[model samples]
Target: MRYCSIPCRVVGALLFGSVAANAFAQVGQQSVPLSADDNAEVEHVWRFAQETESRSSLPRAVDANWIENARLGTLKLSGCAAALVSADGLAVTSATCLRSLENWIRPDDSVFVAGTLLEERKLPGLTARQLVEIREFARIEEASEDLETGFEAELIAADDSSTFWEYVWRTYGDVRLVVIPPADVTDFGNEEGVYPRYAIDFALFRVYDGQALPLETESYFAWNDRSPYVRERLFATAFDANTPFTVITLSDTFSYNGTISPPHTTLYGMLDQYYSHGATGAWELTEDWLSGIKENDLATALNFSVVGECAQTGAGLINVDMEILGIAFDNANTEEGTRCVVMSTSGILALLRTVLKAQGVADELAEQALP
Candidate 1:
């Protein structure tokens, strides 16, 4: 992953114009909220706000309600993305993307882990922007002027139409590193884009407001400690220069069990070769867990179809219930196309528990659930 000199949100607004315009024609001015019938099956916290514009531009395969929820918790980084995983500024993203903080990483320091909060190092001049409000208008000038300080606004229009969407963002400047696994775990096998992969591939960080305190926001995703299973429907949220904001559908979740065959074309094609190809494999991994806690293979990776487009690195993979399953760290290629690869939050949870046990921090992960 590469760090960007310019804020990616601004880039997203510039790139979203064409797509947003095209979406305006496909759906009504307003979007339908999540159906009550579906909510009866499973209570969902991801509800569409009245201020959110029609999300026709997002993939139709995913529920727009969940997509809106995902967007609200998303933070645009220099060249990657992160998901707000707790109410108190804790976020999860790909460990690889944190290379942007190389300057702060001392030569003698262990790049592989950050055992405690006292060890969390701040990256000065770095900032993250969260999409706090979305307002649509008949004309750019019609947008409200209630902009607050420290927040930035961007206007996006489709073609020459009077319709426009004003994106309001709250920027956080004091970001610090939290818990991170060793590179050996995050980049396990160093296989980069290969399938049948195993890697932790995730990292944690905290965002602080101007008061130099942990940011407290209600729009955050709770961590899902359980593993994703086969045939499960999931969504990946990320941003890139190509598509500033994206919510890609990931279905047919499976674990790679058989040997890699030749002529692997697309992720779908690779899976089509065998029956019952989905499974989950886990093992015990221990390095230095604070006071040395032992645990089974907490690191888990799930493979899924990259519907429509490949997800950008550091994208958060969220389930239907709006809980975050993991982070998309890499995209593997088959003969046909590319597929998104995700690492479950189990590994991060394991590390957090270890830190809490040894360091005795009660606020670890903002009191979020863990196993």
Candidate 2:
């Protein structure tokens, strides 16, 4: 299926126009704080909760850091910014982030790099590089009425008045933007088998010429791709609404499971619901208890859906570690409410690691640092 409704520009203009007047009126207002009981609930589902008890937490922290570093040169594409995963420049971001980059590049062009933080500077001194394009492990495609889609994108161009030097000195960085490829697909035959069902929906690119590099900072997370198990405590550090660069230990591992599905679709998986304080472009995964449905091997796959008033065509769903889980591509509004559906993360990872390993760059790119 193809999208034939209003163009995104028109929709954005209408949405922004409707909300622009109220932007500052409610700006900086924090969401209602979770009560101690609520906080306990959050802890029950988040990955960070178990870190204090788990010795494996160190490697997971490294993995998080590696994911953040890789995002350096990449544009947040969606409202959610990219994070580094590797010290050498591998980035782990939502698959939806690639949509904007794909829109910006020419279809015939096989290679493109997006410049982040550097877009506003007039300086010819900073150079941009086009690194190899990494194949995405998943894509957002049009789904049938019975099927739902979950994906979203945000484009962040530098404000013209901004300067690279000023950004580097005052904000702990310079930024650049680059273009990458688009990865979207839909359609799986029963014959493909359920145990290894996969989707290719994320793209990889690089950024360079930044000051106060991520490696220089004391803040960062570790990588742990070798062993992924459920109930393993983990942490997530994201830019607070007030301070874009200030890292805070937001949440912990609530619960998790790691068995591959044998066949058939799984249902009722829970994801963590971390509070988002009007974070212009952020998405949350449901609680972990809900995600536990995948523990059984007979379920070869699963799907995600968002319950809200907004349309689902472009919403994004991600893991607590900020890995791209799926994209919102379809929705259904009922007296119960609108439920936006997304493809599952297991599908994407299966395809991504396979392709990355084929090129002999999966591990390196997954652990590379931002240049």
Candidate 3:
């Protein structure tokens, strides 16, 4: 049940929020508009959608409307990004991203598993922000808008210049913890820099409105129970952890390698070297074709690529149609670069169904049409 292919590096939990982008931006230069060839590396969701719309006919790829929907469903957490999976405000994220919840649990209880809505615990001061609007301007002064009720503005400069982006976010502070597996299950092996992992590595929470009821959300990513095939086209939408502002969702495309069965259905892919050094982050999109996947059905080999190492926990792996394939929870070091290990949605749905059924709420989760 061990990963035959060993990882050189393993990423720890990363949190990104509220930091000003001025430190990461070019303080004295006018930011330039995204060029036509800006598709390779990470690009802002708005700019990426603009490019997608301009394409005459790109089959099986996301369009501007798809990007808008994804932006609305994504929530920026203090530790990582989470996707709204159900219309009733249920969100799925990496268990590692929620280690802070352990502090709230009783000291004697090793893990916190809320069996029902009544068992869910409120996390004080924890908030999740959803992007409501994105506005771009060449200069900061050109950006002026009266924020709607319950919305807040976050001004951020582009990568290297004064060009400012005003990101309006709707903050939801009444987030309640729903479920989290034990640490041993979420982080199997306890082996750093190892892969072909069998870890389920996930947690769930529900966002509540001021009335303390589940927030009704029109925008969300439906669960895709099928596992992704190798060479399948996929993309990720998440905020860059190194950036000062966490509201801007960056989009990047990559292909998935076949799953390694036996120990677990682990999805791996070839990701470029995207690592952050302290406060600065690297965004270059370069793939190493030389890195090949090692297959083993009896055991398993775990090695995959993801958008970014830090602050990417809980980011969703989406297809062109905007369906959720899996979630990025852990990263690994390979000869190629820093790659990620993704827990397939099929497996996640199975685990969640088991938990909900035990809690006598399987029917509630099944209503979402998740298999």
Candidate 1: 10-residue stretch with minimal lDDT:
12-21
Candidate 2 deviation (Cα RMSD): 19.3
> How far off is residue 355 in model 2, in Å?
3.5
C-alpha TM-score for every candidate: 0.67, 0.34, 0.67
Per-residue CA lDDT of model 1 for 172-211, tens digit only, reads 8889987655554455445677554556567778898888
lDDT of 2 by residue, 71-165 (tens): 23222322344444334443444344445333443456433333332322221222222111211112223211231122222222123412111
* Candidate-wise lDDT, in order: 0.54, 0.28, 0.54
Superposed by TM-score, candidate 1 places the C-alpha of residue 123 at a distance from the truth, in angstroms, of 1.2
Clashes by residue pair, model 3? 196-302, 269-304, 269-305, 304-340
Candidate 3, 197: how far from true, in Å?
0.5
Give the per-residue Cα lDDT of candidate 1 at 133.
70
Q: How accurate is candidate 3 locally (lDDT)?
A: 0.54
- State the TM-score for model 2: 0.34
Model 3 misplacement above 4 A: 1-42, 52-60, 100-102, 142-149, 158-162, 242-311, 355-362
What's model 2's lDDT at 85? Answer: 37
